[model samples]
Target: MNIEHLNVNGMELAVVSSDEIVIIDTQSALDLAMTVKYETNVANIVIDKNIICEDFFILSTGIAGEILQKFINYHVKVAVYGDYSHYTSKPLKDFIYEANHGKDFFFVATRDEAIQKLTETQ
Candidate 1:
């Protein structure tokens, strides 16, 4: 995984890029809150949504929700990019739809779209 810091609204935003999965490994809510507070003007972030481990499946939804809550609490936008066609869970699909409707969260099919969404957020 590679992380690049970009200037957005005069704040540094971390852009994590990886062929496998994108992860934000903030130690705690306070850490994330600090990052968000400092990067308040940052509009969006792109995260890889691919699940690599079987054990992760159980926690993925909660993790996704937690991330979304953080974004919402901070008034930041986010885009999760990956192929979600393999997942046919109704609840998951519904969650995706709900997230897409919000200006803060987007579920994109391609990395290009994710980047576009994150960069274009105003």
Candidate 2:
């Protein structure tokens, strides 16, 4: 995994990139956030969606909700960026739409947009 730190509006953000899936479950998601916080002292993170397990996008599995809840509990804001147009589940689409309108979590198309979402004021 490669972690790049960026400062936007005086807020530190960690951009995590990895070739393999990093978050296979809720525990793994929390671990990633904790690792980022420990390494960079940043509460905000931007991760490539490809690094997350495909199960996370399946709303029926409840992985997305569980992982996001862990992030919220730990006060770790995360922005996941990638191409999500391939997902056809309406529930997943609605979940993404709702999350995008809120703080702490975001689903966006690019790294730059993820960074923008993370750095924005609450």
Candidate 3:
């Protein structure tokens, strides 16, 4: 869980990069907004997705929504990386689909895809 702070649009974006997973733990809407604002400039955040825990299923979804809402508010784009196949809940799956389809949020299976999606300019 290596975390680093980055400057994006004059806002601090915390970036956590690891061999197992890379999580950008946004402590507030401003943190999320900053991340989305410079999502494209940051690259190769996570090399693998196997480090993500199954327990993060619900928390991750909630965080994604929160981040997306902030991104929408600021008109920015961001990508979330993790595997959703382990989850058996139908509603959670629906939420994931909805977030992925939206411009502000993207749910991906691989780190590469995550970085690509995040970096893509909208």
Best by lDDT: 2
* Per-residue alpha-carbon lDDT of candidate 2 for residues 32-105, written as tens digits (9 for 90 to 100): 99889999999899999999999999888999999999999999999999999999999999999999998889
Please provide, for model 3 over 1-122, each residue's C-alpha lDDT reduced to its tens digit, 9 standing for 90 to 100: 44454544444333444565333433443453445336534422322334343433565456645545655666555555666687788777888788777656667887557655555532
Rank candidates, lDDT, best first: 2, 1, 3
In model 3, pairs of residues that clash are: 40-119
Whose TM-score is higher: candidate 1's or candidate 3's? 1
lDDT of 1: 0.58
lDDT of 1 at 114: 73
Ten contiguous residues minimizing lDDT sum, candidate 3:
43-52
**Which stretches of model 3 miss by more than 4 angstroms?**
1-26, 32-56, 59-64, 119-121
Which scores greater on TM-score, model 2 or model 3? 2
Better candidate number, 1 or 3, judged by lDDT: 1
TM-score of each: 0.63, 0.97, 0.53
What is the lDDT, from 0 to 100, of the residue 84 in candidate 3? 66
Cα-based lDDT for every prediction: 0.58, 0.92, 0.52
Error of 3 at 122 (Å): 3.6
